[model samples]
Target chain A: MNDMARLQKQRLALYGWMLVAPALALMSLFAFYPAIATLWHSLFTRGTTRRPSVFAGIENYNDLFADPTFWIVVWNNLIYAGITIPVSIIFALAMALWANAHIPARSFVRSAYFTPTILPMIAAANLWLFFYTPDLGVIDQITGFFGASPTNWLGQPETALASVIMVTIWKEAGFFMIFYLAALQTIPPDLREAARIEGAGRWTYTRRVLLPLLMPTTIFVFVNAMINSVKLIDHLFILTKGGPNNASKLILYWIWEMAFAYFDSPHAAAMTILVLLTLGLVAVIQFRLVEKRTHYR
Target chain B: MNTALASRPAKRALPDFDKVLDALGAWVLAIVWISPLLFATWAALQPSGTALGLDFSNPLTFENFTYVWNAVPWAGYFANTVVLVTLILAGQLVLCTLAGFAFARFEFRGRDTIFILVLLQLFILPEVLIVENYAIVSKLGLFDTALGIGLPYMASAFGIFLLRQAFKSVPVELEEAARIEGCSWMGVLWKVYVPAAKPVYLAYALVSIATHWNNFLWPLIVTNSPDTRPLTVGLSLFGAPETGVDISVISAATIMTVAPLLIAFLIFQRQFIQAFLRAGIR
Candidate 1:
């Protein structure tokens, strides 16, 4: 009887371990292992062949700090994130308000706004590349219609980076609008009615009630949008290759170039470490904001 | 008496004004929202020679579609993408469920610490670690394989966090009742926990598929050869500098690549919007 009881206990313990085993194992290998290995790679120098590598201490990181291109990439990323986040958030809120209003064909308008969100970033980039073409694209034709000279949207150093940022905002705004819409739904209907009964103006109600209520959603959007801006590189590759003299060079794009184009694995790893550190800082800010907001709520 | 009555009327009058303003604003916004997409669809139909032409006289043609298909291996890409997305989803569902349950129910030591560490992974994205990840994949002999491409995302922190939240909401009494009835832990999970979390599972599935379907950089790096390359990466090769691609052909290719998801979104927009809202609740 005791032996049977021991057997049952063993089986239950086995079952419990099995339940958590797959998750722990997969995460350890894929997520945790790669992250640790990346840190290791940063400390190593590449040998003659790609396969062989040796420990090289802080040299890779040293090269990163001294490189002018590294600074340029960092500057570009900051400018891109700074411009895109606020613009996208404002646009998203405006769109959500428009959609949430008693509009004719509201459903159609909502889907139309979100159409770009469903499209792949690469595909959208390609489509926009067509429009940005100087000689044969649609944007040039539109300019010509207005009797203006055709602009080399992607070809020029000055316009290329701005063009990329614009496309990103256009793609992201409507998607963020959905979050705003959800937040809008959660607002009690009686509040809006009571505001109306109290003789509150539209702008007054929006400022006093809606904006404050939307604060959490706005913060959430800001964090995700910032993360996206830092990580976005697909469009850069097809759009300009960080060029018209590397005007559009972002940190991640530069890391890709370092690893694949330059075949400098150590330098790429070092740059990646920097990107990770930046992300960590952003995350800290996000957590503090979230905690403070929760307290306010 | 007249002045006091007039003021109350003004209060009622203000809502009427707001309504009119909202209605007008909605129509104006709708037109602006729809125009760019309508223009893109219009342009997609035009031939290369006349696509950029300002004239509206040239009729729409299917030649661009023909050109796109013949120019790229889109069929092969479509097949590879299906395999990749499906494999990733299957792996994630199982892994996330287990981890989520563990975090939600188990009284294991250091649980919060380990879970917090997992959540920290959200900040350290795979893109930033792509260089070393590639090295790791090559070492494991998973390069040029769908499993390799999907491996990085299989244990998603978002999924774990989301499912954990949902699992926690299931009543403890229900779990206890199942235990009293001589139900095994696995039976309770399958019978009670999963059933209760069905809506969350659906929402997570859609989000996962949408994300992985549109994923570009990692798959581009891991899968080099055409046999393994997904649609986005495959389409890149078609438009490489070595091969001069016309604007119309590229647009056609773009449409082909994005059409499936767009069509699905249109068909199930209600569900899509609902799922998206659920995700936002996070």
Candidate 2:
């Protein structure tokens, strides 16, 4: 290029670096550096007094594979994510549709649908803890009026994860609903009117036209819901703490326990590396979809 | 034509069954969805004994609130949360805004690559790095401080991404005009770009405040003592199994911890929802 062009480019480069320096520095310190550090740390065993720090070289990964608890937690997390993601998405869409439709007390309905998103998961857990409490709990009291037996919802291993799943759905659906609501609002009224003119039933129009239009939103919500299932296990701290033999334990929550409770830093690091890999893969897929969707615009 | 016009009036006057059912369904779901919060309110306002029964006719009292308020060092927790959220928000705004402006405006080598790397943080959240982050925090002697709690979140990928989009949308003429006025890089940003992105800043601030205000896992891991513990952590401790699950008192504590955002949401429900709507559009 010309000398003037070269100098302008150089100036741009310098100014760009100067502007982004603070953000880059902080990200390196916290995210990028720690990510590499976690992977590096995962390659070694924790040191004790007698044995100085030495390389274990994938021994932690081997242990993680062999460890039954790790496998159990992995399965539990898959189950958690499997159930919560789809159910929450469906509930979100339903609630959004209902909220957006010509209904009585439209604002109140929308508020009710969206209110749960604001409340802290810990607080929600605390509230649900009361609901899941034995015969004294509201669920049991209502069930008892119909001659049903009272069940210990949170105590039993079989029901514990499911109970937590219920809370996850409750907490996540409203947040996802907002996105669907936004998507719904963007759909032209004329399309619905035209569909009616074409003698399309509600079911046919929704299935053929509306849902196709909402595909981008559905993918976005699904990806977010998946990521949420990975990261959003805060309610577990109050609700279950991976209780009843690790039935409700998610991968992230398991890592926390390994690192802090057991003080097994290396194993936790290995787990962290695994989670990062999974997240990385998921991110790649999400970006591909987002790229297509945004580019399509 | 006369028959058709008469039929239109008759149909309009008739009660629409489907519409009535839809409204009923909406009300039922709304009631069911909000029943947990309703239950918590019921439990908090009544005596613990009657709360279990779902009794609403009993004498209502603020005894649980008073008990919860006096029982915990809630003021300390609230102070920590306010300080932490403010710090994180300030840090995010400054860092994200500058970085966003750079990506949006400047033509530089490896710009796209660096921006993509920054966006990689969208998926590799700080929460996932807690194991190493804890070590990093303690190494920096920032353990149990609000800074430690807020540090990792300050460089938010979401914020940077949102602000970059906002900055890109601001007409280039404004920036050029500011520069023509002999404004420095920061001056152009201040005089033109930042002012133009005000609505975006407000929307982002809402998301940041709500997210940080309810943020649990990181602060929970980083902060050990009550001195630096945010409301979520404090409330978790109060509701732990060992704390004796006095439902009424725990409900009271939960309400107090979440009250500020909840109250704000109840008042500015439109803005709150709109902010989330805006943020989610990405």
Candidate 3:
């Protein structure tokens, strides 16, 4: 190439660097640096009045491994995910199917289904907070008509996590419904005509053909819901605080308490690493699923 | 499939009994789904338990709202949230636009590699790395401030990715013509690229505002005082166990915090829904 062309190429490269610099610098500070720093910081013991700081080498992990609360948090999170993920997906698919169907006042129904998604989880928690209140609560009042005893929803060990799970499912299903709605809209009309001509029942057609067609959206929403299961503990702060002997605590909330409330940064760091690893696995699956979906298209 | 059938109403010849049952079931489920929000509005308008107990004749009152307004510094929370979201959106637009432009058009050494690294931020979200991020924020002397809450999210990976895709689709001829008109690199970007991406900017801004406005946890940890607490944190604090949990008062507070966004969504329901579809599709 000519000298002028080479100089212009160099100038373009310089411009590229300059353009990306601010975003790269900001991301490094918050996203990238912290990811590395979490691993690095997990090695040192938290400083205290007696001890400055010392490398503990996996001692934090050892402590966490032995801690009953850690086990409980992990177990609770598994149950939370197991229940919310599938149930919400089912509910989302149902919502999408209904909203997309030829129903009277369908937009109103769609609006109702989609509103919870836009509201903050904290607000949703607070709204449900009163429903679980003991005597004066709404649930008890309704059950009182049947002469049934009122149960402590968020206060009890058994019911607290279940209550939170319900809220998560409620918040998520509508959000996922939108994607399913979009996906539902994309399925060709000729398929419906072919199914009708074949004399397939509505249920049979939906189960066999529709579900397979929606596999991509189902996978996408499932991954998103899985990530949200970990990310969404905002309601816990208002509703339970992972309380009633820590029955409702998730791993993320536990990490928060260990770091901020208890000042156990190393322990929190170790927990953070574990969460990142889990997310990484899920992300890899999501990446491959997306790749496959693109290939199919 | 059902939606397609519905659109062609002429072909929806038969309203079978099974179809009627399905539609009824859907309405029932949708009611149950949104009952909490519906309850919040009703309870906020009337006394709390009465709404839940199906006593509609109870005189509607604004006493709960007045009590909640008096109980908390909602004005401060509102202002903080406004400032925080506005600041974050502005920073994201400028930063993401620059980075997206480079990723889309400019070719530099390690350009593809760096772009891949940036995309990885989607998986390793800042939400997950709160432990170290909090420490870093406090260390940078940005602790307990709006900047601290908003700074971590300013360079959004999602925004960069979306804008990159948007910019890439812009016709190269537009850029060349601008260049021929003696436009500088920044000038070409300002005039040619950004205007073509207006829809993207609007979509991203809406998502950002909604997300940041409702954001909790980080703000809960970072901001110790009401001065920096956004509406989410502030509402949670007001409704926390330490304060006596009056259902009416808390509902009123909840309604107040969510009302602005709720109203916006109501007015721009189609836009918000389409924006979310756009976000998801991307």
Question: For residues A37-62, could you state the per-residue lDDT of candidate 1 as single tens digits?
Answer: 77888899877855677788998999
Q: TM-score ranking from best to worst? A: 3, 2, 1
Model 1 RMSD in Å is 4.0
Give the best candidate by TM-score. 3
Q: How would you encode candidate 2's per-residue C-alpha lDDT over A1-297 as one tens digit per residue?
A: 699998988988899999898998989999999999998999998988998779989999999999999899999999999999999999999888888877769899989988889888899898898789989898898899999999988888999999999998988899999998888888877786677678777789889988889989999999999999898899899888898788888999999999999999999999999998998899889889989988877
Clashing pairs in 2: none
Looking at model 1, the pairs that clash are: none
Docking class of 2: medium
TM-score of each: 0.92, 0.96, 0.96
Ranking of models by lDDT: 3, 2, 1
Highest-scoring model, DockQ: 3
Q: Looking at candidate 3, what is the lDDT of residue B1?
A: 32
Q: Alpha carbon lDDT of residue B56, candidate 1?
A: 93
Model 2 ranges off by over 4 Å: A1-9, A291-297, B1-15
How high is the CA lDDT of each candidate model? 0.82, 0.88, 0.89
RMSD, each candidate, Å? 4.0, 3.0, 2.2
